[model samples]
Target chain A: MAEQSITSKPQSLKSSYWKAISAIVWKDLVAELRSRESISAMLVFSLLVILIFNFALELDIGTRRTVTAGVLWSTFAFAGTLGLNRSMAVEKERDCLDGLLLSPVDRSAIYFGKAISNLTFMLIMEVIVLPIYSVLYNINLFNPGLLLVILLGSIGYTAVGTLLASMAVQTRTRDLMLPILLFPVVLPILIAAVKASSGFLSGANINDIFPWLRLLIAYDVIFIALAFMVFDYVVEE
Target chain B: MKTKPRTLIALDILALILLGVSSYLALVFAPTEATMGQVQRIFYFHVATAWVGMLGFIAAGISGIIFLVTRNLKWDRVEVASVEISLVFFFITIVLGSIWARPIWNTWWTWDPRLTTATITELIYIAYFMLRQGIEDPDRRARFGAIYTLIGSVSVPITFMSIRLYRTIHPVVIGTQSAEAQGGFNMTSDMRFAFFFALISFTIIFVDLFWNRIRLGALADKVELLKLKVMQ
Candidate 1:
């Protein structure tokens, strides 16, 4: 903060904030795209989860319709842990995060930047999973309402997941700690997302689905702001 | 060695006595309801423990904010104490609630919002302990603990509400519920005496436990400081 030029114009201040955020986001996105480790693991693990569920549940077509949304979200949620752990692990591995910390930008900028990129990765995985799930279960998963639910749920999930992963990655029990810390905190998003997606698939009235959507939206807004406010403490040396 | 505070000792005794009285009130003073019979006795401790659980959670959350802002080790101690005590009370609350619900709901557990949220909040605090245990440096531990305490506290109410968005069968003790439900009861004046008495007595019990835990945390810090000094 001291390195921030005190006399800098307000317009320039806001731009520089976004500038720092995007730079970090770009750094992560580019690294992940090139290496392809995080998404690939997440994709494979998620498929395995769905595969296990298939054998475990023994769902026929009639049962599959109701269970599909829940299966998809659980897959996404479990897959999410993979991406968060990997992203933070990569930053910690190369000490790039410390370099980011050394910069003059607002720390919260770093938080949002990481969160958005994490959200992007999650959505990309979801996009791939949705169609695969639809084909596998023989149900349409492309409804606009369900997409919105996914977006909102993904935002909330990634927002907290990124923050918790940051803390977890620094701990001695890094791999084991993230999910234990994350799942309880992230439960609300799972509940709301699953419920909203279920409602959409079941062709419930819009009014019936609205409350769950509202819960998801509320979770996203609240947690993103919370993670923004608290990330400074988390990353502080 | 620092001696335990005499006042704490006295309060411990008083707390024991109060617990005995509260149990009597809950067990013998208030007439057992016609529906749930002896099982309804558990409600006294159930609601009381839940009340203290909430008390400790709020204290920990506030201490979390204060520790962050002031960067005071004292508040960090306060935070840990609150969280630990709350964990104990909440565990009791969950168990008692389960016991009470078993005969009525015919299962040890249902996905009722309150029950689910209590479990979630309980896990959050358990994770809080795990986070603190991993860090060796007290300062870093305090910082991480405070940050997590804040996050866990905020998420809990939302978790409660999100689950609560569905239908609830949790006994509406104070509110209007038809007399037909299994555990629902209208408090007669004697029952009211025991109910309010249990709440008041538990507040005292929570304070006493919190004071003892804080003292323990302070002593632990002192021992750590002395060990480092000896090494130097």
Candidate 2:
């Protein structure tokens, strides 16, 4: 009876921790669905970026082969900052963050919750962007490898972006502050993602693409852990 | 106001003298290279300032971690000083590199991995200051600053590695020479002397500047406290 009680206690605690994380994620999703603020802005901004690159790079047939990956990744990165800023800004403006903090779950649960939601928003943006890019540019971006790279890249990007966005919204400059703080630190994700995407698009050797994929995975793991460890300090009163 | 420490004053004088001597060694004493001629002298100061910059980068990363872990404001000050010093020194390194590259690489700039990484690192710290400036509370500023610095330091090396996947034309002086490396040269005895002397002198100068910056930060903190007291 004693052994069963001790074992059951940890299992229940584990389940509750997960429940708290899911609850926070659910809250953000439902709020975003009603408002459609972040996703809509991000989507429109990403399309504009692609349109600008159209004239800016003059994405001709020859150049498009080399630059499609770069153009797509750049759009996503810019749109990403928008979503990250808006998501965290909503929390700060509405005092939702404080309420979340006041709850009895672990601080990292808040970090994971916010990061996952941010990742979800970014992935949605990417999914919409890719199809439009493919149709507009007459290029096929439907490769499984490209999708995998996009997934890994978004995870790393949002992991760091969410953490930085939380800090940025508290600052005086607010939205302006997020990109400055995020871009330089997030360069690894951008570099690796662009390279791997280009390699897949160009039909480069699998072995060549593997290094960047590994880098993306490593970055995602390292930053998620770092964010978890430091989220407590970032949100403390 | 408190007076500057005597040791610091002595160190300042020492740094100035060393800087003067190192300049002489690099310009006059060192032999002009066969390939690059007189422009190669910039390498001495270039490598030295980059070394100092790297030292500060490491120091800032360590102090930032310490600040986050201990929640002590002292380490925050140290981290800021390190970032500021590294930022300036790295700018000097980039400019000097550009000057040398013009005559050697035949272009004012190329998108080499090292050059790109240095510029991005500079941007990261500039963003660090912006982040700190936007915050009103000192504790929160320090916390955010430390966290950003930690993130910047880790990302920079990885950024370097990812870019390095592309071919680099930047000369690797201390490492195995790649055939494609432009403006590569073997150091003569005298050149080596100037190089090592410049490194040592710049390190001393870095220490002096860092100490002074930390002192300035402390005084700024004191003034903030006094102002708060007056307001009360």
Candidate 3:
């Protein structure tokens, strides 16, 4: 390996921090693509939830529009939780978390990196489920506004989810604790996303959707900032 | 530590007297509400306890932050004290709210915003203690407890907003508007006197109980350290 000269500039350190985050996110995505364990479990679990909701709610086309956003978000929330708990659990179980912590990178880099990977899993699940749901219910869920809301919601959800999961995974009751810890905190994002998504899908007035969109954005900003600032405490040894 | 300080003793006496007077004022002094009659008297204690609960929550969050910043066991004691008192007061608040709700809303429970938020806030604190229980290392437990309290402090308000928004957007088709919806009468002159007195009395009681709880925490810590030293 070439001997890279050590740099003392703060800006370089900052850039490298982002680079490290991207690297971790990339690693997880590549690993997940090769193994297909986390997403597969999440997808199957989500499908089952939707199936149960199918029988439970009996969503015909008429009723589906009203409930589509709720069912989809509920599925994402549960499945996202599953993915998050397992993702961090995998890191802990394999002793990868300690190794990553020992790396010569900022801790927030690892926080963001894991958050992005977890967000990717949730977003991918959302993307795959939407099409199948649309096909089943004869409704197209490919609206741009709805997609934006999903992205914002997922970002906010995964931001807190990743932080809380890190803490939960350290506990003796690791996996079981994440949902109990995450749900109450991340509720605003879920509410706004479902409300906005439902509005966009049902062709409701833009005015009805604007408040939810704003709420989603606000939650994303607040929680992502909060998670990033406090993540150091969460993952500190 | 200093022997159970004289001020706390004085305050304890004051608290008991205030509690007695406040109860008398509420039960006998305040005029009977027109609509729900006597059960409405629970509002005096209910609001008093709720105020104490909110104060405890704020105190817990502040102590949690102080503990994290200073890494002192004193702040941890404060945190635990606030949580314990808040748990007890909030429990009273919920029960009194329920009792008051029954005759007013004609239901034992309604998923009203304040009621739901109170329950959720209670659970958050409960989970805070559970998180603390799972960790054996005092330092680590303090650290994690502080972090969780910070998280709860921010999230509770957002939770309240979301639930309130949900209710406004889609209200219950069947149930009457919550207890608040039952057109609660304005406080009469005597009722206001009783209410304010109850609030002040509970504030004193909270301080007394919190001081005792902090002493208990310090004693527990001493015992834990002693046990560790003996074992070693």
Candidate 4:
């Protein structure tokens, strides 16, 4: 951004998309790794949510398995919002977003870049929390099926969360607006994820849980496509 | 701007007449029910309000896509109008529904898919306004509004479906597994007439209100423009 002077050069579509996307994702990853701000905050917040639910709920051995899915999904959802709000706020504060917008790369590269980084942070939090939940509850969440559901669910959550978070950060309300705006939109993802997780945990038949999976995939695809197509409008000067 | 359009006048009166006739039919034309009796009358307005709410939701979603493509503030006005109208209609529907549920289901509320989804949709609508209000830039506000509306539209249907799935699988049908778990009723010819009439009338009423709201929005825009000019 040092050379804020307008460049008349046009960035080619194909190369800019992948190049800028990977660069943005890598930047966010490296930045997060060093500062440990967004990830650590999200991770600690998720653990606290789990801890609160542990005391708030009376999950006896019988009811424990049934509820672990709900507890995990809600914790992830709240933590996802935390990560999204911080990630976007950081960009706004540093003028990094302005720098990116001024670049020759396609605007969508920025969207994908931010979304993947946000998703990575959420998944990392989940990776840390799931085992803790499993150990505390004596529930086995190691099933590959459950893991897949978590991935699909986080994808849907982050895709929409990233878009909404971008808007929320620009608003005067900032972080508070993120959850209020994100929760209702990301509800389908949360519901589908929780149901699918429960199905997997309960050893429900694969045929039965297929609809939830389809829902997760459908939501992830629709929102991701929408965010890509519309990110330009959202970020336009 | 000096004189009101005759079509607007006619539409306003027509909406009034339709509402009167629809209420008459709902209250007087239809016979009393076998099981529920007079309380069933709420169904007419309840169903109509819910229908209008859905209409507004769809209109908002479409206007959002249009605004995003055209970057036109006009479509953004339409989006806000539809959302606000739908919010009012949904509020009525929820209240009337709670009233209807009291005697029939012996409860004020149930976590039915429709009920829960309606509440969530209303919350989204409120959040939409909050999001818009927090931004000072008009263009950016409209842009963000459209994006959030689209996101809300895409997710609500899936929310309904997921809730429906959970209900069917878990079956909160209490002890009995009867179809009447949520108060099923067979509509007679007269009740059917009233129900359908309510739906048709509400659609017209929604359009009428939508048109008026847009006009109000235009006036508001004018005021904003004048205020800006004065400030400059």
**What is the C-alpha local distance difference test score of each model?**
0.89, 0.93, 0.84, 0.87
Residue by residue across B97-162, what tens digits does model 2's lDDT show? Answer: 999999899998998899999999999989999899999999999999999999988899999999
- Identify the leading candidate in terms of lDDT: 2
Q: Residue by residue across B1-232, what tens digits does model 4's lDDT show?
A: 5456789889999999999999999999998988889998998899899999999999999999999889899999999999999999999999998998888878888888888999999999999999999999999999999988988898899889888875532123225454425566778989989989999999999999999998898889989999999999
User: How much of the real interface does each model capture, measured as fnat?
Assistant: 0.75, 0.93, 0.45, 0.93
Docking class of 4: medium
Q: For model 3, how does the per-residue alpha-carbon lDDT over A1-237 read when each residue is reduced to its tens digit?
A: 111322434556667887788778887998899999999999999999999999999899788869999999999999998999988988897799999999999899999999999998998988999899888888888899889988999999998899989988888778877888888777778878988888888889998789788888888888889888878887788
Candidate 1 residue runs with Cα over 4 Å from true position:
A1-11, B178-181
What TM-score does candidate 1 get on C-alpha atoms?
Answer: 0.95
TM-score of chain A of each: 0.94, 0.94, 0.93, 0.93
Q: Model 1 misses residue A18 by how many Å? A: 1.2
For model 3, name the residue pairs that clash: none
Put down candidate 3 lDDT per residue, B101-188, tens digits, no spaces.
7666767887766777788888888778777777777888888888888888888887777767654321221345443345356677
TM-score of 2: 0.96
Q: Write the per-residue lDDT of candidate 1 for residues B51-111, one digit (tens) a residue.
A: 9999999999999999999998999999999998899999999999889888987889888
All candidates: TM-score:
0.95, 0.96, 0.92, 0.93
Worst 10 residues of 3 chain A by lDDT: A1-10
Which structure among the candidates has the greatest TM-score? Answer: 2
Taking chain A of model 4 alone, its TM-score versus the true chain A equals 0.93
